[model samples]
Target: MSFDVICLIAEWAPAVGACRESRGADFYWDAPENPNGEDLPFAIERARRGFDFIEAGFYYEILRRRLPSRVRGKADSFFGSVYHELGPGCPEPPDDLADDVGIELAKHEMYYSMRPTTVRSVLEHARAVPWPEIEHAATSAVMPPRITRHDVRDIEHFRSIVWFHQDWLDEAARTGRGLIVLISQ
Candidate 1:
């Protein structure tokens, strides 16, 4: 019943740095590429090999796994259950990447971008999941104070935050999705 949680480190570098500067082993960083580089593809490729979850603001190849399968005629619908759309102006990842990879990968990207901003929001979302189904909790090593608290809390009122990392190694290991995580060095 272990579920994987992916954190978007590249998108939230400022917040992560702030959290790390303030918090302890609660967060860490491990990126092979210069997150600020101009080449997005190289960044993505390096990320693919290094982490299970990617943190790019723009949707990359790995996120395609998160999308629901679009069969020939069986009510062609996206996997809305786990997929969520971000703000209107947000930059979208390449369509080819999304199409080639699974939509779940996109879902992970969206999740990282839209993680709850408040403790209450996080608590509510975490509580929605049945405890019996969750065996592992994962998140970026660096996160906002509120999100970090939500990912680390052990109270019955909220979902238990089990493990936190900058990559998605835990998620890939659990789901078998060949996704990678991206972060800034």
Candidate 2:
């Protein structure tokens, strides 16, 4: 049986189109300018169109899946505080609720600030941990210092182009055959 794979391309509208043209594979391009572009809908209409899905932010998925629960909890608290602060002419929270919310928001802020570094650390941990059970038993297996160092270096390189490089965008502008869709999750 042939497997259908969904590729989510964030900020790489042109390359995604090129790939769809060349490989006949589905493409989804989420970019800043066209947050709700028509690429996905058009692709669906075309007979040979392989592009299937569209989403605004791919980082959110990584953040949701790979980030630790502690970090997520902190983020939630931060959001709650923001909601409270910007309420619709509502009364202030009780002292207990305010204190709890304040602590949670602070913790969340800390986690938000350290997200990049935390991501790097988590990726390092993944590489060091053995297959099948990275969290349970394999995390304790000590890796060489060089391994951690090298992974961090690689992560830095990846951070540079997590979105499509500039050249890809220029190429897309040159070719106006396909659409680039963006959907905010």
Candidate 3:
């Protein structure tokens, strides 16, 4: 089955110890009340600042923008999963924003960070590539089982469709909890 990314926001400090025995999608320290589904905000633009698999990549670009120029380039060259999973007692997102801005993963995929490099690539490709080019390209070559390909509209949607909030993402990054992306497909 094709996979989709969802932000699995935890309510309490995640029980990472409990996650040790779980694998793949089970990597989560603890499951939220709902795992396969979560809510979406009502206001479109405000919702845009929250999580949706479609536009979250754009938010990652925003994070990449904050990095120092030199580090940004260096970080660009190194590509692997940039995940910030919860440690034993990972900090939780602000109660006010958490539910309004998180996702529940599909059974087949797990989460990771989209990071700047990936985000940059998405933005650039959106500007330059057409759907055919995407098919010819080894999109997401590094993350094989995952998707690297997107259509012209897909890129537009990424640029405009997803929602993100720097405060929430910043909290996640600062606390070593990262912008969630689905991986391990």
Highest TM-score model number: 3
TM for every model, in the order presented, reads 0.20, 0.18, 0.31
| Model 2, C-alpha of 34: deviation from truth (Å) | 36
Best by lDDT: 3
Output the better candidate (1/3) by TM-score.
3
In candidate 3, stretches whose alpha carbon ends up further than 4 angstroms from where it belongs are 10-15, 27-108, 111-150, 153-156, 161-168, 174-176, 183-185
Question: How badly does each model clash, as a count of residue pairs?
Answer: 20, 4, 9
lDDT tens string, model 1, 1-185?
A: 12344333222333334334534212223333446773222212223211222222112112223322232011111111112232232233222222322233333222322211222232233234332322122121222244322232222312111123212323333332233222232
Cα TM-score of candidate 3: 0.31
Q: What are the root-mean-square deviations of the candidates from the true structure over C-alphas?
A: 17.4, 18.2, 13.1
lDDT of each: 0.26, 0.27, 0.32
Q: Give the per-residue lDDT digits (tens) of candidate 2, residues 1-185.
A: 11122222222344334444533222333422346764543332211111111110122222324435554443323222212232222222122211222232222111111112222332343233222321222234332244322232222232333223122223323433222222212
Off by over 4 Å in 2: 1-61, 64-155, 163-166, 177-185
Best of the two (1, 2) by TM-score: 1
